[model samples]
Target chain A: MDQFIKINSLKKVFGEGEDEVHAFGPVDISIKSGEFVSVLGPSGCGKSTLMLMMAGLLEPTSGEIYFDDKSVSGPKNDIGIMFQDNTLVPWRTVEGNIKLQLELRNLDISKYKDKIFNILKSVKLEDFAKRYPSELSGGMQQRAAFCQAMIHEPNTILLDEPLGKLDAMTREKIRSDIQNLWMINKPTVIFVTHSIEEAVQLSSRVILISPRPGIVDREINIDLPYPRDLSVKRSNKFFEYVHEIQEVFHEYGVI
Target chain B: MASSKNKLSGFLKWIASGWMLILFFVLFFLFWEYSIPLFDVPRYILPAPTEIVQKGSADIDKLIYYTGVTGLETIIGYAIAIILGLGFGIAISFSSILRRTLYPFFVSIEMTPKIAFAPLFISWFGFGLLPKVIIVVLVCFFPIVLNAILAFNSLSNELTLFHRSTGANPLKTFFKIRLPAAMPQCFVGFKYAAINATVGATIAEFIGSDQGLGFYISIVTGNMRPDLAFAGIFFLTLLGLSLFGFVTLMEKILIPWHISMKRINK
Candidate 1:
């Protein structure tokens, strides 16, 4: 597997001198091309900080990140990010929000209209193309946000607990939708989440980070087959994987 | 049939919500009309509402002309303030140095009695429409600039990061993300500015101008025609309401996606 993203001992510290706070790192991570990796940890563990550094949204206090052999300096066009909150501009309609990806890239909207419409249709938001974020349900908004992030068809996608605030049913549905999307697109994804089950379900590998000044404590391979559904979650195999990840947390005394 | 019944119910609901306000105004005005005579109050002290209405109707054309002048001053001043406010706001937001240098200056100006500037404006511009417009701009400019600063700074880190990650240039990010996200707050500033614009114009006219409702009121009151002064006041109220309503209507049209606007639309 080609290393699409390589993080070399990245560290982030806030403030200076006496007031300094260690955010995360001296952490190293490498993600393969077309791989889905989840960073799971306890709250305030700087999992999100790690993800941000990977996305080039946050500057590492010290260290380097490489994307496809090129050092990541700043936000790259080929990277997509979705935050925990669906940060859809409130004033834009569903279609408009999706179109923002194309607009930002200065891509021809007329050429991509069909592509956008198709994405909306696939997400079951075709009827809500004209509706605003405020008019949509939490799940629908998250779906719209997912569409927004994926619209430009970035090679690498970084998600910061995108489904953390959603209800269980909605979360499961979006998680599955994400899986189906990943299966189709095969983009390298670095998803940050606190949910062990979510990490187990979605990622090809799970990177567990220890609480605060977070370090990559463990990496667990899901070894699950593709096209996973709710039934797989019920199976003993899924529980075993979940249990295995939970035990890593138990070792850290985090759970 | 169902549609018509729904319309009827909607109308009934509207009336139900508004009846108290209507009743309060009516009873209050009736008391004013009767109490003036009962208490033997002179006309110049407190004219009856009927007397004021009669005086207003008699001078309707003159009143309308003054109303138009004041309205124009308010609208034009507000428009200028909107442009300048947004410009200054963006400038301040774009650079921390400028924000630090200019924020206190703006705060001091805002804190200073706006009326204190009235005489200086009249002296510089000489009691013309220009002075009144300047006053309106001065009065209305602060809220817009302040609110715009608030709006621009209020851009969420996630949204900015999303924009940046998509390769949006700073200019594109500002226009597409910052401006749109800040619109609801911008409208709030606009609403306050609109109302203040009217007050600004009227205050300028009260100090110096001779061709607005403010001037007309001064003249009528000096002439001991309290009824006509009351009529001028009535027109002023209308001007305030009209400007406020116009801004609110624009808000609805522009930011129907805003939660408050969305709820209203629903």
Candidate 2:
């Protein structure tokens, strides 16, 4: 796979003059297609900001992002994004919410009916397709959100802590579910999270961002085998990868 | 078979939930019936419920006619307000120019007592259907518009981001995501406007109209027939409740997925 996304010297400054706050940085990173890259950082470290800019939802104060050699000026339909909040349209059912992406992309909804079911089934939400977001548990709602993000089958997926709101058990469950879904499609995913274990477990490469005015602190390649489940999580190899990232945060006084 | 049984149980539970309120009203009415005579309260001052019911039944045709007139005015004015309020609200949400110019103007109009305009409307439009409808419009329009503005503006930041990421056009976003997301709050406006609709029509009638429950109440009260006046008031209450009920029904139909409605269903 070729270089799918490139962020060069990107910086974001909020407000102006006297009140200016340097939110993110002159950070540089390149993600190849089909690579699961996690942007690990502490709170207020602009990980979410970085993801937003990459998705072309937020314009950086300076620098540019290239997607497949094309300069990203505005929001691109070729990439899927999920935020911490499930953001499911409460009025729509789980299936209807996923269908919404297809509807927005002007794709024929009838064609993706099978895909919708399959995605829902992968997230264990097959029975919940007809249920409203409010009726679902917090984890279930996030799973539905995951389905929505995957429905378009975009080449790139930007996930900004999509499982941030779920409890420990549910987050672990959904995390694996997300991996399973991502494996099936093999979309290049930029997963932004504060968790060292999460970053190490899910991504092929982990990009650690430091505190405010965030810059790439370290890039650790996780050469772990496929299906980084409980066994992989318990392995000495995974612990070593997690400890390495933790040491970076430790240096930043984040932990 | 289990589903049918569940349905039966659900029906029974619904009835059980409602009966206590009905029973309270029944008891209260009984107490009022006996206490009025015990207190030696003059019939003209406050007619007993029984007397009001008797007088109301006897004058049912006239009462129904006036009720219909007021109901018509309320419905028309309320419907027009719904369309105009929602239109302006959506427009204001889309355009900063409209928000700056029209929004403050609407706020100022809303701040002033709408009932005060009843006499002015009657003088301008005369003692006819027009004046009453105008008053109803003034009363109902502001709440709907205000709530609508709040509703449309209340789309969550995450949802807005999701919408942007999809590259959904403004028109599609408004209909598919923004509109549906704004609905629960919009229903808040709708229900409030429904409550105000009757008040607007009745107050306008009080100032000028020759027809309607409001006019009937004024005339009967002046003629020292409190029973008949109360009967007119009784019809007005029914009209207000039914109008409110209609909006609530729409809310249930449109947003059954809403948390408020979900709690009710549970």
Candidate 3:
């Protein structure tokens, strides 16, 4: 597969000198187009910082990031992102929130209204376009966040634990929702999660990092097929790989 | 769909308005209307309800005329207040040093009593509408400007980060996001100052002017016509309430998504 996005020797330092904490570092990563990759690690693992650096929201202390063979110095329009908190403006109606992408572009929105409506329908939020974010359930709000991020049809999606805030049932459901959405959109999605099961279920390529100034400890490629569901976890084939991933974690002293 | 919902809401609001507060107004009116009669009081001592109504009807043309003067002053004063308030609010919020440098002086000015300054104003402005308008601006600007600052502060860091990540420049961020976020705050200032501006204008009229509702009240009370004074008082109250309601209406129209409007009636 051709290099769609490449990160070369990325490093991030929080402060200068003695007060400084070395955060992320010297890591190389390349993601192929339309690949579903998950970066899994424990808390304070600097995985999030790496994602931010990749999205051009953060400047690495050193090294380079390139998207489609061009150096990414800052945030570009072609990148989509979803955070843990669904940052929908409470004052805006659901349609207003969805149209924020069009609004930002200063372009005429009449061309994209149908596309936005289709996304709302796909997210099952069509009946809720007139309502505010506060009126929706936690799960629904996250779905709206997802729709807004992917609406612009960006090449890459950085999901920073978008389902982390939800309850178990809602988390599991949104996990499927996101997987299916990615299937349709086919964006190069780099999902960051603490949950190994979640990473296994969704990612075709899982990059596990060691704690504190995280470097890639393991890169496991899952041969799992598409349309994965909760029952897939119960299959013997799934456990075989889960054991292997667990062994990688053990080797990294993360178990 | 909206109108019927509003009507239903209006009816519910009217019922809710009576939810233990209107009884106080009823009691106040009843006591004023009946207490004087029971005590065999003269009009100077206290005006009866019928007498107040009679006095009001007897001087309808004159009362309306003076109401116009006070009402006009109030309106002009309020408009000037809003313009200045919004301008000052935006300015102060955008600049940190300006806020700190001017805050003390602004607070002192807001604190100084209008009644004490009225005679000086009258001496300078000579019973015209300018003095009243100035007072209105003084009273209204502080709350509105302060409210604007409050609105600016209420934006979450997470939300700001989201917009900043989208490659939106500062101007785009301010106009599209921060401005709308501060709008509800602007409405708060609008609501507060609308009523307060009228009060400021009235206070100015009371001490200085020779021809306003304040002047009308003085003449009626001096002539031992407290009922007519009561009528004038009621007119003033209605005017204040109407002005307040107008600001609230603007707020609802501008920001229907505000949490206050979305609240379901109990």
Candidate 4:
């Protein structure tokens, strides 16, 4: 498998001298194309900072990030991002908000009409195309946000705990929603999350990080079949993976 | 049939929404109208509602003309303030240097008593419409500009990161994301400026002016014509209310999806 994304000794420090804070890193990660990877850690673990650097949205204090063998020094267009809060523009309807991606990239909207429709239908938000973000429920808003992130079908997606704000039921349902969606394009994904069960349930591999100024402590492969769901989660293998990750967190005194 | 029913319901809703305030004012007016003779109060001191209406109608032409003059000043001044305020807001939002420096300078200016500048403006710009408009702009500009600055800068870090990830050019981000996101807040400034616009215009007229409801009220009160003064006050109240209403209407038209609109509509 070709390494689609390579992070080499990336580090971030917030200030200088007395006020300086080590945010994250001196860490390395290699993700193959179409691989689903989760960077999981406890609160203040700097997982988000690492994700931000990889997406080229933040300047790393040192080291480098390479996407498809090219150095990513700044924001790159071939990436989609989702955050904990669904930041849909309130003035726009769900459809309009989704179309913003196309408009910003100067893509031909007419050509993508059917594609947009299909994505919205896949998320069961087709009936809510005309509703504004403020009008939608928390779950629906996040679903719409998911559609927005996937609309462009970018080569890689970086999600910063996109389901963090949701209730347990909604979180479980969207966990499978994300799996189904990732299968459609098979884009490389680096998901930043705190939930061990969530990381095990979705990503093919989970990269565990130690608490603050986070560094990679371990990487465990799920080696599970595709279309993972509740039934799959009920399996003994799933429980083992979850237990294994829980033990690491417990060892680090993070749980 | 359905259309008529909808219209009837709409009318009923409108009445239902307004009847309480209308009823309260009606009772208040009737009490005032009847209380004058019952209390044997002097007409000049506390004129009956009937006397104010009679006096007001007798000078209807003058009242309307001055109301128009004040209204024009308020609207023009408010419009200019909106333009300048929003422009400054957008500018500061883009540049950190401006946000750090210009923002504090503007805040200091807002902190000073704005009405104190009314006489200074009259001396500099003279008694023409220019001075009054200047006062109105001064009064209306700060709230709008302040709120706009807050609005434009208030975007969340997550959203900013999302914008950056899109690789959107700065201009595209401003227009497509920043500007639209700023509207609900900018309208907050706009509505506040609307209320202040009338006060600014009236203060300017009060300090020194040949025409306007403010000047009219001042002159009539000086002549001991309380009834006519009350009439002028009535016209001024109408001007203020209508200006405020116009702003609210624009807010509804522009951002019907705003939380403020949703609350009010509910």
By DockQ, the best candidate is 2
User: Tens digit of lDDT per residue, candidate 4, span A180-212?
Assistant: 899988999999999999999999999998987
Report the poorest 10 consecutive residues by lDDT, candidate 2 chain A.
Answer: A245-254
Model 2: DockQ against the native? Answer: 0.83
DockQ of 4: 0.79
Task: Give fnat, all candidates.
Answer: 0.88, 0.91, 0.40, 0.84
lDDT per residue for candidate 2 within B168-215, as digits (tens), equals 889998889889889999999899999999999988888887889999
**Higher-scoring candidate on lDDT, 1 or 2:** 2
Candidate 2 local lDDT, residue A36: 97
TM-score of chain B taken alone, candidate 1: 0.94
Candidate 2 residue-wise lDDT, A1-255, digit = tens: 788788889999999999999999989999999999999999999999998888888889999899888998998878888889876988888999999889988999999989999889998899999898888899999989988988888888989998887799988888899889888979999999988888888999999898998999889999998788899999999999988877778888888
Q: Compare the candidates by TM-score and give the number of the best one.
A: 4
Q: Tens digits of per-residue lDDT for model 1 on A100-129?
A: 888989988899888888888888899999
Model 4: per-residue Cα lDDT at residue B24: 99
Off by over 4 Å in 4: none
Q: Compute the lDDT of residue A155 as modeled in candidate 1.
A: 85
The DockQ-based CAPRI class assigned to model 3 is: acceptable
DockQ of 3: 0.43
Off by over 4 Å in 1: B1-13
Which is the winner by lDDT between candidate 2 and candidate 4? 4
Per-residue CA lDDT of candidate 3, range A191-213, in tens? 99988888989999999888898
Q: Give the per-residue Cα lDDT of candidate 4 at B38.
A: 93
